[model samples]
Target: MTEFILPSNANDLNFRHRLPDKRLAPWVQCLWSMGRPGHLTESRTEKFYPDAGASLSIKLTSPHPIITLCFNKTTLIETLDTTAPCLGIRFKAAGTHCLLGLLPEAFTDTHYRLDNELEPLGLQGLIPVVERLYQSDSQQGLRLLETWLLHRLESQPPANSRITKIVQAIGALQLPPQQLGATLGFTRRTLERKLKREVGVTPGQLVAYARLNRARHGLLATTLPLTEIALQCGYYDQAHFTHAFQSLAYETPAAYRKRKLSQIYKA
Candidate 1:
């Protein structure tokens, strides 16, 4: 299940669920959480869901790529990490009109295929729909939500957790491929192949993305020195770290810290 932590019940923007589980599909969802002034605790299982364009939408707008997230379930359920809390704007399963007003294949049902590399669905796809909903009464909001999400989740099985586990393991690593592969109980080649099969990226690429995400958080949340941050995040040195950051985040670490993050303490 997708977990959401509501800081206050009295708050108007309470996000309970977005509905349906795709490999990670809620292509375009929305929530006030992105602009939240404070920080929130998200465990590793629900660690920050990082994508090339994971969002922070303030206004309702166009649909974006949907992501379906499933929880990790194992033989030893107690041992496997289970729940994660988050808040975001997201797409409703099979909400045809909500996703760019496009009809399904007209013959087929699904929008994305195994090899479909979707471009980012942006805010414009959602605003009109949301604005219309907002202008209506509270019952209308619930009606809109029901119309979008309640229709199909019952018919579909939830996504498997294997993909989530693979992603979590890869993202957890702070070492090179051989070392990380060993930690994940697979050979280097096997790890690479499986990761690509499940996640559409190589193990090394996943790690690189993960490393940049970790650095972004640290640079924003802590006053830790660059050298210390670099070492902790698995860089051979600050130079390599900076190079990777530039490639991944499109800015030098220092610049991102100063320009993008004025003060981002955890919630």
Candidate 2:
């Protein structure tokens, strides 16, 4: 699981990640809790880049709601005005459709209010649990949600093995799409359709996301120069890397690094 915590740098914000229960492990990636104190003097904004899958979240704030969010195709910028407690269930690459009963393509680059989508499917039982989440502690809320998922999974189909394989190959090998398609015994066209349906993005977009994801990790963990980081992440040059990074991250790599470091020092 991926956990993001900047306690020392930004005490107002905290995020926790937990492993999925064994029964739901094949379809779920992780369970997460994130939020900030409502009394903060200044607001915050977070930028989320494209990833491999989607999530169902309970947002505890004004216009309180539960929603299903598809993996982003471009950058997603979220502005926080008050205390925002969020609990999320991240789905595996090919898992959301079985639970949500919607094609992954239908969700790309957007979020659907859960009640509006799930009510038609007789999932109204979820509303009470969501209300309890807003009234109880985070752990209790998470446990309730987990239980609901377990019940939901009892009748859901298994994840698509081929889509999982393709995602695994993309993360591990970073091969060109055509070569990856060939390896999977698929033509490029066939592969694109499958990826769009299962992963919410086309092959080329996934590759770019993979490259940027690696660069993001390197930026946070290493002292390497920007040019070196660019090459290591498979970009042709620093200039090209800067363009892509800024497009997705909303800041140049150097600026992002500096801001992070400044936060640590100030803390």
User: How high is each candidate's TM-score?
Assistant: 0.47, 0.82
Maximum-TM-score candidate: 2
259: Cα error in model 1, Å:
1.3
C-alpha lDDT (0 to 100) for residue 53 of candidate 2? 60
- Native-referenced Cα lDDT, model 1: 0.44
RMSD of candidates 1 onward, in order: 13.1, 3.3
TM-score for candidate 1, residues paired by index: 0.47
Rate residue 209 of model 1 by lDDT.
65
Model 2 segments beyond 4 Å from truth?
1-10, 22-27, 35-42, 61-70, 81-84, 121-125
What 10-residue stretch in candidate 1 is worst by lDDT? 73-82
